[model samples]
Target: MDVIYANSELICSTNASINKCSRYKGQKTLKKEVTVHKWIKVSLIVLSVCLVFAFGGVCTLAILLSHATPLAFFNSDFSVPVSDQDQNATDYKAQFDALRHQHEETLRKLNRLNYSTGCALCAVHWIHSGGKCYYFSKFKMNWTQSRDHCVCLGGHLVIINSKAEQDFVNSNVKVTHWIGLNDLETEGHWVWVNKQPVNDSVEFWIKRENGIREPDNWTKGHPDGEDCAGLGHPGGETDFWSDAFCSLEKRFVCEAPAAV
Candidate 1:
């Protein structure tokens, strides 16, 4: 009986040991599975965040590209709507055209008035469209010097505001008379005595080959670096102008005008 009991006790102990080992192994396996699941979840979360950021970046880039316009003329490859720029250019051109037309009408009215009502012994030899009369000086003058003379005479050097005025000046002056147009105030932006912009289309007559260096426009020789302008006869002939010195004596034109 005692031996049987010992055998029984030993078998029971062995069974208990096996069950504990199995339970421990089961717990360890569950723990490993949980760790693996946690790692997988963390990896998925990280990847999702990266993907969202990448997609957002792509969307932003696409949006920017859609708005950009190609500017090939200026060597800018990007494309963007140039509607505003075009509108601005159009507005400027319209303003310039209107100003030119107004100048023309003003001169026509002056011519009609002059024909009806003549002047004194010193008849109006020249008529500026923008309300002025010009009497070419019998002497020559440099640009600055001539301008000063005009100011003293209570006016400015004659500014050819239109083709008609230019033609008129060309007809009256036998020699080039110092006029008010010059790039002296701002180089490359030629302005008349009245500070009006010289139209690029109306080519001012220059001395033969005088504008060789700057082939874009007409420029008479003689008063180099003096910022002077002169008038010429109708046949593209330049007759008068002076350098920077106002002291030099030359023929001058006086101006007066009928009311517009």
Candidate 2:
């Protein structure tokens, strides 16, 4: 009886030990499954974050490309060499300067043309004839004063050198006017204002019908000696030069070179 009881106790102890071991193994398997599931979830989350960042980068690049100008894309300095760029800038500047010079030259030529024409170059109320400009003054002044006035006007008193010029002055004068011929320095030796001696051979002095010549210095019996010359209708003879007193106030003619 004792032996049988011993064998049964031993069998019961072995069964309890086996059942505890089986339960421990089942718990370990459940822990392993939970760890694997956690690893899979973490990997899936990382992949999703990577996919989102890649898509956002692509969209930002596309937006930038769309907003950029066509020229901006082509204007990059890397496409052209530095020396070529400098050469192009120099060429462009040279072309601009050339065009500016051409424009200035054209303006100068137009101004010269306007100045060279006869009547167009003369001042208002001035007459142009024989490459000269003449101004007939309406006011009266003494011979010296008239010469000074002509000087102030950038000219001198009329110096008639030919019959045609004498005729022109005689025909244009409204009344007796002072001319540039005078013997102010030495009496009876006539000279032009420019200091040239007058040639009496081709002189335009009026000759009377009785063969008497003018410039007789005859001014109503008062002979301080007429030193200044004038052109007018003296003795009913027009287009003739006559010596007159320097102090006599008379209308004058001024002459200047015509602008060319």
Candidate 3:
């Protein structure tokens, strides 16, 4: 009878230990699950808040968040890993710059009234982008006339330095607008309003379907040939540039540095 009691006590003790271990493991699992759930909730809230802030015309919140940390925009260190193996970290500076530029441009388009009516960095009726202010003309003028008008407004004809600037102009203009590119001094040698030679790397000339490239110096009427560059020709084509007679009256875009 003593042997039976001793064996029963051993079994009860073993069962009690097993129960304690099981309870501990269950609690541990519950804690891990709760942590994951909380992380997910916070992620959702951050994304929703960013969207709301951006749409409310206060996208500077997004910028501030980006500047907070190198990984604030991507969150690799504290993010929950879905895979057992580690994921490679990527350099997203280029992508982040592009996103920020696009976001600012989108905001300008969304609230043109506020931006155009009054800007701290730009004049009333001018729009700011990439540290520059642009004035899109509402009236038509010859190339020389337009250039002079832009000068009168403390600016020059728009000079496109990069693809981003080219894209910005493309998005803003609806009709064929005269650009800063011209070959007036030396035919076939295009120059910008800043007197800088057009970089072949960034030129956006049109290639004809037959494989012919522009600056063909095709003359419409004048003996000097087409000396001015115009983009988005009406009803003929859009998204490519063509040389036109400088005497032709057309709308133009002016560019100037933003106020300090």
Best by TM-score: 3
User: For all candidates, what are the clash counts?
Assistant: 29, 0, 0
Sort by TM-score, best first: what order? 3, 2, 1
Each model's lDDT: 0.61, 0.79, 0.81
Tens digits of per-residue lDDT, candidate 3, 1-260, equal 99999999999999999999999999999999999999999999999998997787666766675467645524556454323223323336566567757655754564565556564367789998987889999999999999999977767899988899999988888889998989899887899877899998998898888998787887656677988998856565646788888888999999876643
78-196 per-residue lDDT for model 2 (tens digits): 55555676899999999978875765575456557866653245557778776667999999999999999987676789888777777777778757788898888987788988888
Give stretches of model 2 more than 4 Å off. 1-120, 219-223, 233-235
All candidates: TM-score: 0.40, 0.52, 0.53
229: Cα error in model 3, Å:
0.7
Writing each residue's lDDT as its tens digit, candidate 1 over 136-236 gives: 77666655677777655545677665677767766776654666666666656767667777676765544345544322333345343445455543244
**What value of lDDT does candidate 1 attain over all alpha carbons?**
0.61
Show where candidate 1 strays beyond 4 Å: 1-131, 207-226, 232-236, 239-250, 254-256
Candidate 3 residue runs with Cα over 4 Å from true position: 1-120
Cα RMSD, each candidate: 14.5, 25.7, 23.7
Better of 1 and 3 by lDDT: 3
